[model samples]
Target: METSQITDLKRILANSLEGIEDPIERSRSDFCFYLENVVHDEGPHALTDYIQLADFHREIADTLMDDKTSFLLVEAFRGSGKSSLASVAWPAYLASLNPSLRFALISKTDDQAITQLTGIEAILRSAEHQRIFGDLVPHRQYYNFRAPWSEQEKVIVRPKFSRFPTFLAAGVESSLVVGKRFDCLVADDVIDLTSSFSPTTRNRIKHWFYQVLLPTRDQRWSKVVVIGTPWVADDLYDSIAKEMAGKSFFKHIRIPAIQTEQTDHGPIYKSAWPEVFPLTNLNRIKSEGHFAFQNQYMLERYDVTQSILKKEWLKLIQQDYIPKELTILQGIDPNAGRVTGKTGDMLALATVGIDADRQAYLLDLVYIKGDIQEQLLHITDHITRWNPKDIASEIEATQAHFKNYLEAKLKETLGLDITIRGITSKNVPKPIRLRAMFDAFIAGKVLVAAHVNWETGDLEPLPSLLPFVEEWISYSANAPHDDALDAVDIALSSVLEYGGRLAALTIPSEAIIIKDRENLEKEEEMSEEDLELADLLEKYEKNMTGTSVLANPSRFFQRRINFRGLNL
Candidate 1:
C-alpha cells in the first residue's frame, strides 16, 4: 500500500531467500519474485489473472502449499489450461512457500510431458514475468531448470543453487521405475481416456501409476496430482470415484465445458460446490461451443446412435440412386413367433439397393404382425413392383419354412428369384464393420437417397446403430444379443461384399501382370511367317487390357472418390 510497507515487504522477501539452504536459495528467490512482484500488480512482470486457472485449480494449489492434502485431482475439458495451472502456477506457488520443494511433471507419454514443459518455459519467458525473475531456462539433458539469480545487490548475493530444479519428463508407464523421489509429483493427463478405453492400455497405465508413481514419495509431505479430460465411462475417473467414495484424501473437481441439465434445472447452492465447478461468465461462450452440455457438464455419456449414421448417409445413398432404374434388395431378421407376449422383439425385414455406382441404399422396411406366409407375401408384394435383383435373407433359423415357400410356392406364386444365404457373425468384428462404414461416409462411398423415406423403421434405427456397434464390439461376449446391430451388420456386409462395391473399385496388381503374360505367350506361339502380324496383334491386346485395368482400377474406390472427391 504505502512506500514504507512496500520496502518492508521487499526486505522480507530478500531475507526469506537468504534463510533457505544454498541448494534451494534460487527457488525461494524466484518464488518470491513471482509472488511479491508477479502475483501482485508490481514490477514489469505480473500475472493479470488467476481465475482463468479454474476455481479448483487455485484451491488445489493452496492445499498443496498448506500441506493439507498430498493428492489432488482436477479434471477439465481440453484447451482449459490444466497444464499451466499444475506445472506453472502450482509449482511456482509451492516453491515460494518451501524452497526445498521438488516436483516432477509427468504425462501419459514423453511428447505430452515435453509439450507441458514448453508451456512452463513460455509462461516464465514472457517479457512481463522475465523482467522480475530473469529467464528460467530448462536443461534438456537433466530436464531441470537452471535457477534465476540477481547479481545487482552485494548482500543480495543469493547462494548458488543447483542451476536446475528437479523438473523432469517421464511417461506414465516407464517413469514408474525411476529412483529419484520427488517432494511433489504432478501426473497430468495420467489416464489418457482414449487409451484407457482399451483394456490393455488401461492396465498398463494402472500398473504404472500404482507401481511407479505411488512409490515416488520419500517423505509423508509429498503430493500427487492427477488431472485430465474425462473421455470415457471409466478409467481414472472411476478409480478416483471408487477410492473417494466416502473419504476425503481423494478430491474430485470437474470443470465442465458448459452448463449441464443438472445445473440448469437442478437446485443451486449458496456457495459453490467443491466438486462441481460452474463455468465463469468469461468462459460461457467457448465452453458451450466446444463441447456438448450432456458430455462436458453432466459427465453423462453421449449417444451417437445408428439413427445419426442412417440420417447422414441417407442423402448420399439416395443421391446415388437412379429412381427409375433402382433394383431393390430385401434383408430379413426372422422373429419366429417365439415370444408369448408383446415385450418380445418383432421380426424385421429390410429391403436395400445398389445403384450403378454400387452405393448400398436402404429402400424399405417390412414390419409384420402375422405368420411366416403373411409376412413373406407382404414383403414380396412391396418389392414386387421394383423387380429386385436378389432377396438376401438370413437362413440360419426357420430355414425349412422359407425353403418350402421359395421352392414350392413363393418363387412361382410371386415370380420372385429368391436367394437365401447364411451370414456368419464372425471374422470381421461389428466395430470393424461400423468403422468401415464410418470410413465410407467420411470418404464419401456410402450415402442414402434424397427422395428416400426417413419416417420408416429403416431410418429410425440409424441413431442407435453406431452405439450398438460400439457396445457390440466392447461387450460382445457378455451382452445379451446383437440383433439390432446384426441387421446393420448384414446390410453393410452384403453391400460391401456381395455388391462387390469395395472389391470392384480396388484394382488387383495380379490382374495387370496376368494379362501382360498372356499376351506375351500368345506372341511366342505364333509362326515365323505370321510373327510380325502376331506381334502387332499382341501389342494391341496388351495395350487394351492394360488400358482397361488402368481406366477402371476398382469400382469401389473410384466411385467413392468421384462422389466425395476424396479417396478412402
Candidate 2:
C-alpha cells in the first residue's frame, strides 16, 4: 500500500471509533466498524492489513445507511466486493438496527440468491454477533410456532411484528415475491452475461423489476439498492439511470478499477483500490485483452456479439504477394483539436492499396496523439513513403481549417503542391459507410501482410496491425473511438469511386472495343486536331482492351477530357 492510503485508513479507523463506547452501538452505527470488528470470515487477510478497505466502500456503506436516499444504484467494477458490501453486510446491519424490517435479496437465479442470503445467515449465527448484540435466531421451542429458518427465508425473533420473514431470497423470475411486501430490496447481479446478450432476457428482467418486485416495497418507508457490473449498453442499469434521471432520492455511483488524470506532462493512472488491486496487478489484467479489461474493470460496456465486424473475416497474406502495379491512397481522420492525453481523440491515418484485380490491401496505419505539428509531420512522412495517388480526409466544420494548414505544410516541406480531397459523411450514416467498406473483407477481397518467420514459415500478425485488429474485432455502434475505422472507410470509398466498375464487373464489353472506320476518305479530310483525337482514342482503346481500369481512372478521365472534347 501507498503511504497516503495508510494515512487515510488510520484516519477512517479513528473517525469510526471516536465517540462510541458500546461495541454493539459502534457496529450498528458505522458499517466500516462492523466489517472490522464483527465480520471475520472475509478472506485469509485481515480488513486493515492486506485487504484494506477503500474510501468508495465507505461511501457505498454510508449511502445504503442513509434515510433520505431510498434508491441507490452502484455500478462498480467486478471483484470490488460490491456484492459483499451492499447485499450481505448492509442488509445484516439493517436487521441488527431494526429486527422487524423485512428484506429481499434477489439475484439472476434462485441458487445464486440463496448463496448470498447464506452470507447474512452465517453472520447472524456467528458467536461474535451473539456476544456483541444478542441471539438473532429464535430458540428451538419457538422455531415451528413463531420464527422459521430455512435456505430461502430466515425469520428472526421479532414478537408481535408482521408475518413476512426478516430476510427473503428470490430470483428475478421467481414467484415468491408475488404478493409479499418488504421494507428493503437488494438486487445483486440480476443481469448476468447470458441475459445481457439477449434482448428477450433483458426485457424480461426489466419487466420483473419494474412490474413485480418494485410494487412489493412498502410505500411508507422502503429502500432499494441495485449493485452490479455493467454488462452492455441499454441494459437494466441503463434503464434505471434513465428512469431516475433527476430524482433526489435516487443515488447512482460508478467506481472504475483504474482512474486516469491528465497532468502537465501526461496522463497518470492509479488504481481505485490500490491495496487490493495495485497498478502492477491492473496492468497484468489489461494485458489479457483490451475488450475484457475495458468491459469488466473499466466499466465500459460493449456488446461485440452484436458488432458487424468479426475476427475471422480478416485475411492475412505474405507481403511478397502484392502486385507490382498497385495504386495506393491515404486517408485521414483528424481529431477535432490537438490531443493532450490518453483520453483525447486520436488522429488516424490509413494507407490502402488496390491491384488490377480490384483487391484492397491495408499497407500501413499511423495514429498520432500529440499536437497539430506532430500530426502534420507524421502525415508528411507517410506521404513521402507511400506516394499515394490521392489523399482523402474527413472535412467537417472543425477539420476544414486543419486541412488548409496540412496542405500548406505539405507544400512547404516537400516543395510539391498536393491538393487533398475532402470527404464528407454528413449525408450518410457512419455505420452504413463502415459496413460498405468492410464488405470487401466479407468477400475475401481485403488482405493484410502477415509477419512470417523465415526459417519455420510460421505466420503472425504484424506489430502495426494489432491495434487496428483489436478495434476491428470489438467494433460496435457505441464504441468509444472509431477514428481508425473512419480513416480506412474514407480510403476505401475513394478507391471504389475511382475503380468501382472494375470491382463490380459492371462495365460493358463494347466500351473497350475499337471498331474499324467505315470510310478512309473521311479520315483524309479531317483536320490536325481531329487526327490527334483519333490517335489518342485508338491508344486509349488499346490500353483498355485487356487491362483493368484500377490505375487512377478519375485522373485518366480528367486528363483525356481536358486535352479536347473526346468522348470514349
Candidate 3:
C-alpha cells in the first residue's frame, strides 16, 4: 500500500524477470507463468498457496492459449475458480501482450460483470504487472474521463488504431456493444437458476448470445469463451455444447466435484479438488441436498421434483425371495438403426414378473447397441434363461416388420409357438405412459432383486438393472434418451394389464394395446352393436381375471359391466 513497499515489490519482480529473454512475451505465451508471477492479489504468499492449481486448471489455461481453439466452453463445478483463470487472468495477459486488444466480459447481470472487470483492473494496475508490461494505464490519468478507466470500460494508453475500447464489461442484457467488435469475448454465468428454469428467459438469452454477443467477434484472430456451472438440461450451456460438438476449432471441458469408480467393495468417490474439497467435505455438501449437489457439484442436469421416479422408492428384494408361480413377461424396445458403441442408441429389453399378489418385480434388464439381428439374439438368450410366459414389444408404425421377424425367429429357434404382443405408442407421449406405469411403483407394488453381501449387510444393485435404475432415477420429460424407460414401461404395463389390475391404478388414457392381425380378423365379422359388445368383453377379459379384481366388486360396477351371474 505504501510507495516504498511498492518500489521494493517492483524491483523484486524486475529481478525475477532479468534472466528471461523477452519476459513479456513469455508472460503472453505461458498463461500459467503469467498467472503465477504477474497476476497475484495475495500480499506475500504466492497465488498457489491460496488456490492450488489443479490439472483441470492447467488444461483450461492451455485451451485459452491454444491458437487452434477459437471457441471454448468450460462447465467446471462451483468453487473451481474458472472465472479467475478464463475471465480475469487470461484477459490481462492478452492486454499485456497487445495494448490495443479489445476484450468484452459478459455475465448474467451488469453488477456481476463489473465485479469481474474490477479484478482485471486490479491485476493490470498491480506493481508486478506495470513492472513487466510497462504501465498499461497511466497512473495519473486512471480517474480521468478522457483516458476512460472505469468499472464498465477501460482504454489502455496505446495508439487509437481501432474504434473499440481496450476492455469492456457488460451483462447479457446490455446493448452497449451492438456494433462493436472484439478480439476476445467471454460470456460467464449468463444463465442463472431463475433463467435456467424459464423457457422464455433461456430462449431470450440464447437469442442474445447468437444474434448479438457472438457477432462482436473480430473474425480474424478472435476467441470466444463461455464458462459456467450447468443449471439444467437444454440451458444456454447445453445449447452451446450441442452447437460446438465435433467442431475442430471448439473445445468443451467438464470437470465435476467428485469422480466415481466401482470397485469390489462398492463405489469409490474421488474429489476433483482433493486438497480443497475432499470426499468427506463433498459428502457433507451432498447431505445438504442431492439435487443441488448434483447440479452444482456433480454437473448433472435434472430437477428432483420434476424427475418421474425416485431411487429410494424402488424396493430391493433378495433374489431367492421371488415367488415360484410369478408370471414373467419380457418387453423389448428395438433401436431403429444399427449402432456398435456403448455411447450410441441402444436396444432395451426389460423382463418383469407379476406375482400372485399382482406385485411386479423387475427381474432382468438388458441394454445393447447392435443391429436388429444382434438384438434378437440377446432377446432370445434372455428368454431362454428366464423362460418368460409372454413377450411384449413396442412396435412403431415404421418398425412393424420387427414383430413378424421376432415371432418367426422365436418359433424357429425354440421350436415353440409364441406370439409377440405389439404395443402401439401412436398418440400417447412417452412420459404419460411412463408415469402411468410407475403408479404401481409409487404404491409400493413394484420391486427389484438386489445383490446383497449378507456377511457385511451391504447391498449393491443387480448388474443388469444398474443402467435401468440410473435412467429411472434421472428420467425427466425432456431427457434425451428413454429407451430403458420405454422397455420397463411396456413390460410392467403388460404385466399389469394381463393380471387385470391396470384399471385399479391410473390407466394410460390412450389405449396402447394393439392386437395381432389374426385376432382382429375374428372380430371383423361381428355386427356394429355386437362388435362394440365384443370389444368391451375382450377388454374386460384382458384386463379383469385375478382374485384381486374379484375382491373389488365395486370396481366392476363402476365400469357399468353386467356380471351378475357370469362366473360368480
Over 485-523, each residue of candidate 3 has an lDDT whose tens digit, in order, gives 888887875764578563232111111111222344466
Error of 1 at 396 (Å): 21
lDDT (10s digit) by residue, model 2, range 177-210: 9899899999999987667766778899899999
RMSD of each: 20.3, 23.0, 20.5
Q: Write down the RMSD of candidate 2 (Cα, Å).
A: 23.0
Question: Which of the two, 1 or 3, has more TM-score?
Answer: 3
Clashes per candidate, residues 3 or more apart or on different chains: 29, 0, 1
Q: What is candidate 2's TM-score against the reference?
A: 0.54
- What TM-score would every model get versus the actual structure? 0.47, 0.54, 0.52
Scored by CA lDDT, what does every candidate get? 0.49, 0.76, 0.74
- List where candidate 1 sits over 4 angstroms from the true fold: 1-64, 92-100, 138-165, 232-234, 245-249, 260-293, 301-477, 483-568
Candidate 1's displacement at residue 522, Å, is 75
lDDT of 2: 0.76
Q: Write the per-residue lDDT of candidate 1 for residues 367-389, one digit (tens) a residue.
A: 54576567657656765755665
**Rank order (by lDDT, best first):** 2, 3, 1
In terms of TM-score, which candidate is stronger, 2 or 3? 2
